[model samples]
Target: MKKIALILLVFMASAACKTNPFTGKKMLNFYGNSQIFPTAFAQYDQFLNQNKVVETGKDAQMITNVGQRIASAAERWLSANGYPGYLKDYKWEYNLVQDETVNAWCMPGGKIVFYTGILPITQTETGVAVVMGHEVAHALADHGAQRMSAGTLQQLGAVAGNVAIKDERTRNTFNQAYGLGSTVGVMLPFSRSHETEADRIGLQIMAIAGYNPDEAANLWRRMKAKSGGQAPPEFMSTHPSNDTRINNLTAWAPMARQEAAKFGVTSFK
Candidate 1:
């Protein structure tokens, strides 16, 4: 029985192995792009058809323009870095939805939705680019896949630990303890890393798209100001603290600008 179980575990692990493109990290991923992308695309289309998608105005046009530029930048970077046709499956679409929530997100398969309420804080095309770039970076980096991989590992670890323990009551207790430890120690840090990486990559993408990387810092400042001191600390949340994020952006901006220079981005002020 134990031999059979071990064989099964090895097969499962082998099936789940994947290599991350951006970080080059070997990870366990049960789902592939072929499975994830189609689901995301369908969900995105359904969302647009159900929502009040803004159209026929300057604001709408601006959203589309910024999205297009970022998408172009992503394609260029991917191809130059040896991921030719990386975005061939992407059916990119951008929409501004009429909402009061100051939030935005880009789903996998290149669907982006920006809430109108965020525009006031974004304040300019550069600001919008910063936000859009970050969201797009998340998709481009396959952060969603990373997240799912982490979750699967956690579940498998829990099950293996429980099996080793043997006693039902003790196994339950161990599982509970493991859950708490993983949430605080592994999950939170993993989420924070993704956020920081997104910020760095986003800055570069925005610069490559001909938007000023410097605007990234200012955009965070505006986001902080708009929050009115209500956000949680960086350690406990998925996002970095405003100050920490801004400082990191400031440090990374020069590098992004230099990268853009190679692509003829001369004036990023």
Candidate 2:
């Protein structure tokens, strides 16, 4: 049983790998768009039905406008880079919901929601672009499916361990250590890497869309201030520290502009 589980895990990892065009890196994603997108779209629709989705307001318009620009920029980049039709399967939808949580998220297949509470932090269209690009980047990179794949492997490992270990005490000890080690040492870092990847990719796409990439770091600064500097240590947190993000975005802004220059977007809003 243990050998079979291990073989299955290895086979899935090898067979399910795909290359992400933006970063030119291979990703492990067991869930494909055909399997994930319909579920995501239905859930997004259900959530909008249950929530106060602002459909006819300045905020709603801005969300749609910015999201469209970001998505277009991403598409342009992909096509220019030889990945035309990469997003053909994506059903992009954006909505603004009346919620107090200072959060915005993009589901697989480009479903996005912006809570009203995040507007203050966004402050301007460019600020909103900063967030929109990041969310879209997550979708473009298939981060959701990759995380699910990682979680599946994590569970498979636990099961394999239990099957292989005959001593009950040793099995319990292995479970405890594996749980902590896998999360803190592997899972958290994996998530943090994804966040950082999104930041870089988002910066470039937002710049290509004619939004000032500099505002990406500024947005994070505002985010840090809003958090009152309250956050877990970098190693333990799923996302990178605010300071780290600010620094990375600051350094990457110039390069992002260079990327935009290729698209003839010399000035930004």
Candidate 3:
């Protein structure tokens, strides 16, 4: 079982690679949009049905507008950079929910949701653009599929470890240690890196879409205050610290403007 698991892992690693056009890095993504999108779309549809989906409102319209602009900007960048059909299979949809959680997320194939609680912090259309770009970046980069693939491999590895350990006491100890090591040392860092990448890519795309990239950091500043310094430690969390994001976005703002300049987007909203 252990050997078979090892072989499967190796095969998956070799067979499932997709290049991230924004970063020029190869990502492990065993599932493509065909494999992941329908499920996400259905889940997103069910979520919308179960939640209070706001319609015929300014906030909802803003969400849709910002999402479309950010997605178009990403598509423009992809097309210009030799990935012309990168988003051909993506069916983008954006909806605003009447939840007070102050959060937003995008599913595997561009299904997006914005909770009304975030509006106070966002406070403007450009602020929505900032979040919209980041969420869209997740879809563009196929982070969802990659995460699912990684999760499957992680579970398989756990099973393989248990199978190889005949001694009950040793197996129990290994399970506990493995869980902590993998979550903290591997998964947390992996998620943080993805957040950082999305920050940079989203900044550039938003800039290209005629939104000020500098506001990205300002938005995070509001997020930090909203958190009241209550977030988990960076190493234990799945995302980078607010301070880290503020600093990185501040530094990347100028680069994003440069990228926007290439598209003749010299002014921002």
Tens-digit lDDT string for candidate 1 (1-269): 44555565667667866655556766556666787889998898899889999986999999999999998988888888788877777788899999999999987777899999999989999999999999988888777777887787677677667667878999889988999899888888888888898898889999999999988999889888988878776667877888888999999999999988888887863
- Candidate 3: residue 166 Cα off by (Å): 0.5
Q: What tens-digit string does per-residue lDDT give for candidate 3 at 1-269?
A: 88998899889888776899999989989897888999999999999999999997888899999998999999899999999999988999999999999999999989999999999999999999999999999998898998888888888889989999999999999999999998888887988888988888899999999999999999999999999999988999889999999999999999999999999999999
The per-model lDDT (C-alpha) reads: 0.84, 0.96, 0.93
Name the Cα RMSD for model 2: 0.7
Q: What are the clash counts of all predictions, listed in order? A: 0, 0, 0
For residues 75-170, what per-residue lDDT tens digits would candidate 2 score against the true structure? 999999999989999989999999999999999999999999999999999999999999999999999999999999999999999999999999
Q: Which whole-number lDDT from 0 to 100 does residue 35 have in model 2?
A: 90
RMSD value for candidate 1: 2.4
Q: On a 0 to 100 scale, what is the lDDT of residue 192 in model 1? A: 89
10 residues in a row with least lDDT, candidate 1: 1-10
